[model samples]
Target chain A: GGIITQTPKFLIGQEGQKLTLKCQQNFNHDTMYWYRQDSGKGLRLIYYSITENDLQKGDLSEGYDASREKKSSFSLTVTSAQKNEMAVFLCASSIPFSNERLFFGHGTKLSVL
Target chain B: GDSVTQTEGLVTLTKGLPVMLNCTYQTTYSPFLFWYVQHLNEAPKLLLKSSTDNKRTEHQGFYATLHKSSSSFHLQKSSVQLSDSALYFCALRNMLSGSFNKLTFGAGTRLAVCP
Candidate 1:
């Protein structure tokens, strides 16, 4: 019955411009994650937080910044949009040590011109 | 380190046929494997997951069994329908690597069921 909401479902930015995506969840989950999805590459983690105001770098964290301003919200910023980058950014959340299932939002599709 | 492999890039099958998508993983720690399905223009959702070896987990008409001996969790469904067309991803949770909520996903397999 809970849902994860991602704002700006689609974004278009010029190369070298900064872009930010927002996510909000009402599941009262303790953990949140940001992943990048490409055509053939599947999904790759960029950042995740287990609690409010905490951030952990993932394998593909470079060139991206994440913030867990509060328990209900997590934000991700693309430091600089790459010309060749056109992918989807997904937001997910879960209750640690409880249910291993993660709830996902529709995702924000990013396109760099 | 943890890794997941899905060898098929695309699978084309007609409706009413049985389907199987290969998934294998590698990890030094205990493996928590998952299968996620993403329909067109929709979010990726958890189809099923399992950490118990040799036990089969089923959901929404799809089934998978975790085999620690071979380190594989293959997704299967009998008599696939047109709605079964989508992208499937196999993921691994490397709990021992300092994070219990992080997942490493494979390249993904796209299934297209035709009439």
Candidate 2:
């Protein structure tokens, strides 16, 4: 079985700072997604890529940017960190050929001071 | 807009007790429903899913039925275990898209199973 890896298990940033999170998957899946999770809240999709170099925005993509530069990797950037922001960023991949069951990364916990 | 709603924020149960977590949703398209479990400090994992109306789907002793008429996919288990304690999320996938299936999730319910 393949694994999904996310860099920087914990992140701390200052207000207005720009930060980035990276994800890599060995599953060789065709689709990748980025989601944000606030404490006690459900995940909100920020962006997703169906293929390399493709990007699609989700409802919560306004403050974020995503890149699918290669098939195995997808990255997300917080355009400008907001003060007192705290959330977890999760990355997932799936193969749509079967019913899509997403495999997720452990998540990056972000704390913006 | 497609969305999911989970009724309780926290549910505490004893081992071997019956369990149920209410999940309801709203969507304009035929929806594919799913239940995910997240252990502390771990990523959420798929627990159960249902695309066929009124059919029950199960995994790891947990089960749920997707009721299209009521827009509900309530999770249930006859016997709860300590391992079952975790955060549970209900999600929906928009089925109208040809290839891309976008998902929307509900605010999670925290399940605590004690001995």
Candidate 3:
């Protein structure tokens, strides 16, 4: 059994500030993903990596950057935070196949002032 | 482009009552449908998934049948409990796309089960 850990369960940032969130998974899964969840909205894919050093953009990649330096770690960066912005960022990992179930982290709640 | 739709934004029910949440989808290719439940402050967990048509799949007392003719996969439970309160999301996987990992999700339905 493995767990996906997301750092800084709660995040607060100022407008125009840059913030970074980190994720680590011990599942050794081949694929990792970042998703953003807003109130009343479904989770939107930000970025995903098929393997270490690989990056793929999703529907909501704009204003966000991701890194997959190692298979166990995937990180996301918000280039410029918007004032009063609030959302939860989730990290997930899955086996090599697409049909495989995804394991998710608790998520990082972000609030920008 | 593929999309999923969950009609109810909020559903309030009493304990012991039957539970049902509507879901519909649109896609050009064969679809894999999934139901995910997220408790307060918890990560969303897969409740059920099915790719076969007219076959019922169930998990944790919840069940859903994939109706290709109606393009629906509605989640239901025989009886509700307070513990059943959570946000439910319906998602679709586009098998035709090269990146099958990509999933399109519905807006989500929030269920509040009271005693």
Candidate 4:
């Protein structure tokens, strides 16, 4: 069995600060995703990496950046934190298209002060 | 573009009563729908999934019938339990890249089963 671990379960940042959240998975899945979750707004995809060093923009990608420098890790960065970006950010991974099930992390709850 | 819709923001039910959460989706290709349940601060986990049209899939006493005709895969359970209280999300599996599978999730429905 494998687990996806997200760093800094709770993140507090100052407005305009650049904040980063990291995710690591031992599942060795090729596809990794970063999703922002908000109350009544559901989960919106931020970025996804198909393999190492590959990054693809999602529906909500304007204010964020992502890196998949290693196959076992994917990280998301909030370019300039805003109060509106305060939400639960989740990281998920899965095998490419096969079965199409996602394994998600516990999520990082962010707050901008 | 692909999208999933879960109309109810919240559903409150008494224990032992039947429950249902509606899920609908839009996709250009054949749709793959999934139900994910999140309990409080825990991570969301897969509750059920279906790809074949008109077949009902069941798990952990919950079931959903995928109807391609109407683009729906509604989750249902005969009896609700307090343990069933959770936020439920419906997702659509989308093909975005040649090597990856992308999912579009609905806003989610919070089901509160009371005693």
Per-residue lDDT of candidate 4, residues A1-113 (tens digit): 89999999999999899999999999999999999999999999999998999999999999999999999999999999996557999999998667657999999999998
Query: How would you class the docking of model 4?
Result: medium
Scoring only the A-chain of each prediction against the true A-chain gives TM-scores of 0.97, 0.96, 0.98, 0.97
Error of 2 at A101 (Å): 0.1
Model 4 misplaced regions, further than 4 Å: B95-100
Q: What digit string (tens of lDDT, one per residue) describes model 4 on residues B42-100? A: 99999998888899899999999999999999999999999999999999885444423
Clashing pairs in 4: none
lDDT of 4 at B32: 76
Q: Model 2: what TM-score for its first chain?
A: 0.96
Error in Å for residue A47 of model 2: 0.5
Q: What is the TM-score of chain B alone in each candidate?
A: 0.97, 0.95, 0.98, 0.95
Q: What is the lDDT of residue B71 in candidate 2?
A: 91
So what's the TM-score on candidate 1? 0.97
Location of the lowest summed lDDT over 10 successive residues in candidate 1 chain A: A94-103
Between which residue pairs do clashes occur in model 3? none
In model 3 chain B, where is the ten-residue run with the lowest total lDDT?
B94-103
- Supply the global lDDT for candidate 1: 0.94
The DockQ values of the predictions, listed in order, are 0.78, 0.70, 0.72, 0.79
**Candidate 3 lDDT tens digits, A1-88:** 9999999999999999999999999999989999999877898999999899999999999999999999999999999999999999
How well does candidate 3 score on lDDT at residue A84? 94
Cα-based lDDT for every prediction:
0.94, 0.91, 0.93, 0.92
- Candidate 2 lDDT tens digits, B16-112: 9999999999988888888999999888999998899988888889999899999999999999999999999999886776534578899999999
